[model samples]
Structures are given as structure tokens and as C-alpha cells.
Target: MQESWRDEVSLLPEELKEILDITAKHNRWRKYETINLIASENTMSPLATSAYMSDMMHRYAEGKPFKRYYQGTRYVDEIEVRVMKLMGELLRADYVDPRPISGTTANASVFRVLGKCGSKAVIAPVQAGAHVSHTKFGTLGALCIEHIEMPYDPDQMNIDVDHAVKLIEEVKPSFVVLGASVYLFPHPVREIADAAHSVNAKLVYDAAHVLGLITGKRWRNPLDHGADLLTASTHKTFPGPQGGIIATRDGQLYKPISRAVFPYFVSNHHLHRLPALAVTAVEMKHFGEAYADQIVRNARALAEALAAEGFKVLGEHLGYTRSHQVVLDVRKQGGGAKAAQLLEEANIIVNKNLLPYDPPDAIKDPSGLRLGVQEMTRYGMKEDNMKDIARFMRRVLIDGEDPRKIAEEVKAYRREYTKVHYCFDVNTLEDGKLYLLY
Candidate 1:
């Protein structure tokens, strides 16, 4: 006797049900269950998340503020103007364009405004932290720009200022890009800017990873240090909804950059993020200093603890890190790929990274692991929590504990620190309500 189809089936299709179930589970795991250490990721505050889900998401307001090509965009213009003003005030820049959708898009806009196809630019080596956007394979290639690698000093985990200055002079490129994805120390922006200017080259600093730290006064502001332009993604340490901004102290570059942003890089500009970005900007204005300080403290603490736990933490001579990240040389623990996989199995998330000595092809299985403490710090984890996290990693990698058992312990530890801090809150939501976007 076959059962009725109604008795055996859900109201929704099985495929849709499975997708919804998987999404819910993923959200539960990533948000409330696992310890996230990815360097390029962060959680938005509840207030900011609320702003991210507006009717603006369904609308479009092409072109610049007060000059849109579409109708019904007066409010969108206001939001964009407010967001730009907030960003400019936060970064101390004369002009800010909050249009580009990602840091790479911001870079592309800069590339378009600075030079045409087949132009040359000097950029940091990938090992020293230059983002892919600055490389020939990313935005540069798309723009038909030639990429000249900057001289990197691996011991300091920064650029070789003397050699870089010489390279900039010798290459005399149209622009010189400063900043890195794996940045531990601040670049020699003033010195490089001087050299770039001497060579008639512009300096574009990609502050995607450390934008929050810079705003919070924990790191040097490149614009203040003589960079002509700066680009950043609002997510990472900035803790905003995903978006990119281009800021400059030079007002003369405004028109070119604005034109490049609209017709070249973006259309409509994702109006939904504008209000959320404004919320985050306000949050940074109020709590960024304390938040950035805690992130750096936690990163250093985690690096120290990991080193004590027999992990080969990088930049030990430079006090581990000045930013929110702590890199590990995982060669001793079976290389970065294996170590990252094992850590993930234990519910400790991190990413494999290329060491300074690694070949470019080793990207598939690099020799280092990149761990960030910014998101964890936002979740109210402190220096002591960093020690516990290091212990978990030690147990998984050194003691050879079963990953499944460690994952259980991880879930328990994570349960204690679920609230997001460093932002304004009305506290109007119900208890146990999931406010996180991921």
C-alpha cells in the first residue's frame, strides 16, 4: 500500500526545502557555532544590518548624487551624499566616492582615472600583501596597465623603502600602489609618495584591510602621509556592509574619479549599502578607537599564544602584528593547506596564504595560514579568549586530538560570545532572534 503523496511531501519543493535548510544550517554554523578567523571578513552590527535590508535594494539611482539618470532617486541621492560626507569626515579626505562595489572595483576606477591602457604602475609583491587588484592578473590587466613589482623586505614584512624608491625612480611608472592584503606593518607611504611624486607618479593606497584601524587612529592614514588617493572596502575591519570607497586629499582628482566610477566601474551603485555604510561610519566615529585597539591587542595576544603553543607565528621580531591579523608559518604542521583543513575540521576557520619564500604557483597549497582577530574582537572576544583559541589550534595540530570532539568543544566555547558589540543598538528585537547576515 503506497502512502498518499501529501503525507510524504512538504508544502515547498524538496529542492527548495533543502536549499533553505542548508542555508539556515550554514548561517547557524558560521554565525553561532564556528570560530571565524578569515582576514578579509567581518560581521555587520544589527543596526547596520537593518539598514542593509531596505527598499533601496530594489531601486536604482544611476550616476552621481543630485545628478542621477533615473527618476525616484531623491532619497537615494540624500543617502549617498550623507554616506560620502561621513566617509570623507571619517578618513579626513577632501573627497570620497562610495560607489564602487568592491575594493578591486575601487582600484579599477583609480586605474581608469590615473592612466590609460598600456600604462605602467609599480605595486607591492603579493607576498608582501599587495591585493590581487593591484596585480597584472586583476584590475591592472583589465586596464592594460603594466605591473612592476615593488621591492619587499620579508624580515620586516614590509616594503624595502630604499629599493622601492629606486625602483619607482627607475620605472617612473604612472602610479605606485601601496598596501597589502597580508599587511602586518604600515608601509612607508610618505617616503614612497615622495619618490612617486619625484618620478611624476601618483600614489594609490589600498587600505581595504586596515581601513577601520586607520579611522580609529591605530594606524597611519595614507592620505595624511602624502598618498594622492586611497581605496578601501567597507567590510573587513571597517565592519560595514560590503562596499568600496575611493578617497583623496586632492580635490582636483574628484571629477575624473567620479566619472570613472559611474560609467566605467559601476551602475546604480547598490543604493542599499549607502544607509548601512552611514550607520557604520557613525559607529566608527564613536567606537572605532576602542574597537581597533582591542582588535590589535587580540591579534598580538593570539600570535603570542600560538607561538607559545609551538606554532610558527610570523613577524615575531616585529611584535607579531600591528593590525588585526596574525600570520602563521604552517610548514612545520604539515604546510598551510593541511593545517588549514585540520583547523577547519575542528571548527576553527582560517585561510592558507603564501609565505614570502613561496613560489607563485604554490598558491594552490601555500606555506602559511592567515588568521584575523577583528571579527572575533567584534564578537566580544578579548586577549584571554585568544589564548583559548590558540590552545584549541594546538590541540588539533600538535596533540592530534580528534577534530570532531574538538568541534563540539568549539561550539560550546562559541556559545558564550554571541553578541555583537561596537555599534549602536535599539535592543528592540526578540530574544534568540538571529540578526547576523551570514
Candidate 2:
């Protein structure tokens, strides 16, 4: 396997080469099947990938295109502006910064802009639906990322913004982060923004997981509801590139935010990737809302289907899920890691995750597994498909417990549904992993 990679590329920066070789081998050569259910993961458009693999990889445009510290940015500037234009239109954002390389970078930029040495940034802890990037581990370098947790309503398993707002007022934080990595329901952005306003703290909507839905209008628009800033990865439910996007709804916040994105924060932004961003934005303008709407449909369907199979699915009373992802507390289904492992053997792909307030041992091998209908849902897999998937899970984790047979059934169903006429050239791949237009 190493030999294959070595043969594929001559430039081997030893350490990176080793990791790349291993990743490729695990993904391509290993006999293990992948039914990746991690909502953060999605299939990129072929054009998006092509844009990433384009000539933009060779340039060193160190500044914003035309204003670069170095020369030869004529085309680079055009591409960057193109990305920015489409991004603003797609997000309905007042100001757009097409710089940050990942969602974490976008959040970091927001933090860096508002957070000083002793500054405070409120966050929902990971157990309470925040991403690791919101934790001490995620904010280690920044020192003094004070925690102002969003209170949860046990009845609904969502943030209690009134209480959270009270905490923000008392703390007088520098920034209030609304949104979560594992949130199973709608976020109270307006209330959160109102709370942050009470304390004069900036409100940042970390829409990393739901950008697709938000853009599609399946979910709330935090900026419209009072959020000052928005942060997200262009991927996830959006089917774009793997990069961060920042948008400010107020003109007053644009310059500082853009400066924060430039010299002070990320310099040498990937110019080549800008075109991919443009392509993604173009795709968004055309199909984003539809893609996002269907993603929610898939989530609700998946949730109901999983519930029917007896797993303790979260967020049913408040009208199930409004996004592409669903959370199932599978501890009753025999533990997340255990179920995920067995499912892998059966050719299904899903990941183990810590449920809200999950125990330490559960974090290690979590009690919950987050599933997404993003890629599969985009393939037009609906409520019925979700049920079939639940049955497969039952067979592997609850009943038959024989993966070979399970894999056979999965393969058959996959062959039938893989032809979901969702995107352009939908069923064009021989390996069955292909699911996008470009």
C-alpha cells in the first residue's frame, strides 16, 4: 500500500507521506466497508475536487488577490472576489470573508477578533452539544476562553436561552457562541443574541453542521435573528469544499472582521481553492436550498425509522430534526462503539459519539451514534430507506449478529438505492462512492 502511494507521488515530505499513505490504504485498500454516518462528513462535488486539484495549488498569493504582498495575483483576485460574491448571495450575509481554511479557523477568527488575553467566550460544552473546537482543548492556545455553558431543557434536550442569557449578563463575556456540533434540535439564536446584546458581547453562530440547512432555509438564520457573526465549513450539508466561511450581517462589523481574516489572522489563503469555493457557491445558488431541505427530510425520516426500531432517538416531540443529522442514544441498542464496530463489519459506516452529559467511559466508546442523511439523503434515500437501515442495525447489533450476511443485504440494497438521481452524473462511479455534480 505504501508502495502504491510512493508510486503515485514523488514529493514525500516523509511525515506527511506516511500519514497520507496510511489514510489512503485504510480508505481504499482495506476490505472494510464504509457507510459513513458522521454528519460532518459528506461527498464533495467532482468540480469542487477538481478545483482543489487545480493549478491554484502552485501559487503563493500571500495577500487578498490584487492587494497581495507578492505579485502575479491577477487571476487569484478574480477568483477570490468570485468566491466572496457567491458566498454573500448564498448566505444572504452582509459581509463575507473567504479566507479561513476550516470552520475552526472561522471560529478562531471570531474569537481572536473579540477575545483578548483575559477575554471570555461562552460556549455549550461538548457534552451539551458543542464541538471540540469549543472546549478547552480546542481553545488551549487562546488562554482564558471562559466557559459560559448554555443551559439545557431536559424535557426538550435543547438550550434554555433565558438561563444562558442570565449567565452571559452576569459574566459579561466577550463573545457568545450559539450552535453546537451535536445539537439535535433548533437553536434559539434570537434569544441568544438578545442575551449577548444585554451584556454587549458579540454573538457568533457556529453553523458548521447546519450551514447546508441554514442556506437551504430548512433551519433558522442566526444573522437574521440577531447574531452579529456566522461561522461555518463550506462542506457538511452544503456539499462544498472543506474550508471555513465567515459572514457578518452588519456593515459596521465588516472591516475589522476582514482585517481579522487578513494580516492579523489568515494570510496566504488558498487562492486555487477559491475557484472551488466559487464553483460550490454557484452550485449553492442553483441547488443549495433544495439539497438542504431534503437533508432535513432525511433526518426526520431517519429519526422516526430508528425510533421505530426501538433506539432512544432524541428530538421527536419538537418535531424531530430540522437538519440532515440525527442522534440516537444507542446505549439501549448495545453501546455506540460496539454497534459501530459491528456495523462496520456489515459494510455500514457510522461513528460513536458522546451523548449530552455522557459518562467518561461513554465518551471513550460513547453511548450515542450520530447518523446523517446528507450524502445518502442527497442520493434520494427517504423514510423507507432509513427504516431498512435501522433493520440492518438491529440484525447486526441486536439479532443475527452475523456481518457477512448483513453485508450481503447491505450490498443488495445499496445497489438499488445507489442510483438516486439527486446530483449530476449521480450514479457515475463504478465503486459506488460517487454522488455529486462538480
Deviation in angstroms for 272 in model 1?
0.7
The clash count for each model shown is 2, 2
- The C-alpha RMSD of each candidate to the native structure, in angstroms, is 3.7, 5.1
Per-prediction TM-score: 0.95, 0.87
* Pairs with steric clashes in candidate 2: 35-349, 47-438
329-426: candidate 1 lDDT, tens digit per residue: 98878889999999899999999999888989899899999999999999999999999999999999889999989999999999999999998764
Index of the highest-lDDT prediction = 1
lDDT for model 2 comes to 0.76
Evaluate model 2: give its TM-score: 0.87
Query: How much is 212 displaced in model 2, in angstroms?
Result: 0.7
Clash number for model 1? 2
Model 1 local distance difference test score: 0.91
